[model samples]
Target: MTLEWFKSSYSTADEPACVEVSWRKSSYSTADGPECVEVAPTPSAVHVRDSKNPDGPQLTVAPTAWVGFIRGTTE
Candidate 1:
């Protein structure tokens, strides 16, 4: 399934410097913070980019790798 792009939860309304992600969440909620990595997930991989430069280069990794990263970070 193709997920829609959404602003990160760490982003605030006043700041144009935001990160957008394709997280499988129900609402288009933005977080309260500044620059962070943005993530967009696809069927095969997860796309990651620097929030400061949306038009810049992105890094793509397998979904499994992404999951492992998340797990590693949280634990």
Candidate 2:
């Protein structure tokens, strides 16, 4: 299957240097590098995808699951 990769705008001007961290914004999308992180903010889940590698795997987490992660980091 073919996947459409999206780039982020929040990304830095030097994209090559910031390849791994590239992510597309769900809002304003264009032919650019990652803006920051693709957020599919729903009541239950949060989705993240790679800007450079759209067909690549994604990271999906329940909103509560992510909260747990953050809470863990605080300790």
Whole-model lDDT per candidate: 0.71, 0.57
> What stretches of model 1 exceed 4 Å from their correct place?
5-34
Shift in Å, residue 51, candidate 2: 1.8
With candidate 1 superimposed using the best TM-score fit, by how many Å does residue 41's alpha carbon deviate from the native?
0.3
Question: In each prediction, how many residue pairs overlap at the backbone (N, C-alpha, C within less than 3 A)?
Answer: 4, 5
User: What's the CA RMSD of model 2 in angstroms?
Assistant: 13.9
Tens digit per residue, CA lDDT, model 1, 5-57: 66677887888756655634223324654657767887778888766666799
Q: Looking at model 1, which ten-residue stretch has the lowest summed lDDT?
A: 23-32
TM-score of each: 0.57, 0.38
Candidate 1 shows a clash count of 4
The segments of candidate 2 whose C-alpha lies over 4 angstroms from its true place after superposition are 1-36, 68-75
Say which candidate scores most in TM-score: 1
Kindly give the stretch of ten consecutive residues in candidate 2 with the minimal lDDT sum.
15-24
What would the per-residue lDDT of candidate 2 be over residues 1-75, giving only the tens digit for each residue? 112344455467666432223233645555674444464545556667765556777898988886787689799
lDDT of 1 at 13: 81
Report the Cα lDDT for candidate 1: 0.71
Q: What's the true lDDT of residue 8 in model 1? A: 75
